[model samples]
Target: MKLTRHMMPLLVMIALLCCSLNGFAAHGEKKPEKKAILLVAFGTSDPEARKVFDRIDEQTRKAFSDVEIRWAFTSKMIRAKLAREGKVLDSPETAMARLMSDGYTHVAVLSLLSSARDMETVAGTLMKNIPGRKPEDAVIFMGHGTGHHPADAIYLAMNQVFQEIDSRAFVRTVEGNLRELDISEIPFERPTRF
Candidate 1:
């Protein structure tokens, strides 16, 4: 296989083809990890809470860069009842559906759960619905969690929500009295849940 005038260009072409094939394989091989963060609120019919929740949504977006993030009312009943009353809301289901349809692979849900009671259940159940998504994907739910409040139900509720979402996703609940907590010690952290 001595290099001749004709063979020189032929060998060069072969080398180029091999390099391109390698480049294509390398570039097309890895599937980038998908992620998103969602601020899930118990939602407000009060219209006043809407203003407060607006701040939460804005802050969460600024925190999680490169991760597709947005807001939603986790309480379908609250959202339904109020949306009819002209709150003009996007339900968590609707929001999640839009994100997934728009090519989001995972969504981290931050719930507006001041008191565990119905609010946590409302948010958790709605977030759990995120499981039946097309392909297996993660849906995170962050609770406002239990604090030094008189009632103990909030922590219990957060634990319950954690149980529901943990099997599918890496979930976390931040109650002041608990371990492994994140985002604790805020003024409105212990607000009365209506």
Candidate 2:
């Protein structure tokens, strides 16, 4: 077969692709990589509220006994609000970067927030299109308690986003706010005190 100048580059590309695939196949089948668990939440400044977070941490540690666990706060506003009160917290980006730098190959993110947007972002980062690492193997996201706030329409919206990306993903709620909340029905003319 006669090879043209343009055909040379195409042939080289095909040859490289084949060689790469063959090399991967030659290494034989690999076992699933171990994963670390990252529990993410919108942290609080109140000492009393912090106990709830602590309890969640304790329960997660007990359940995932074999996995390495870490904590991250997804709210910059909440983090900043806490920092002003003389506390510091790590964001998901900061925590994940540190974990990757420490040679962690896989991560499973669990969000303690009613919303799934931040959790989805972390799951996306962990489950990237990298060679030798299956996206499904690297990460998972669990959104906790989609109720309790008047502004929880955000959680419903986020569930749709997760459904579009991964059918296995979902949102759940526990003990939602007791008050009947209908934004359209509520009259907002007067200033209310907390």
Question: Whole-model Cα lDDT per candidate?
Answer: 0.54, 0.56
Candidate 2, residues 12-36, lDDT tens digits: the string is: 3453344334435536865344467
Model 2: how far is 164 from its true place, Å? 25
Q: Give me the candidate number with maximum lDDT.
A: 2
TM per candidate comes to 0.40, 0.44
Off by over 4 Å in 1: 1-32, 85-88, 113-194
Steric overlap count per candidate? 1, 0
Q: Against the correct fold, how does model 2 do in TM-score?
A: 0.44
- Looking at model 1, residue 126 earns an lDDT score of 63
Q: Please give, for residues 1-194, the per-residue lDDT of candidate 1 as tens digits.
A: 55333353354344334433443454667534467776765566765857777676677667776788777764557778976776666765566566655555455555556454655566566664764553234344554433544333555555556545453433345554443523332223233221
Per-residue lDDT value at 143 in model 2: 37
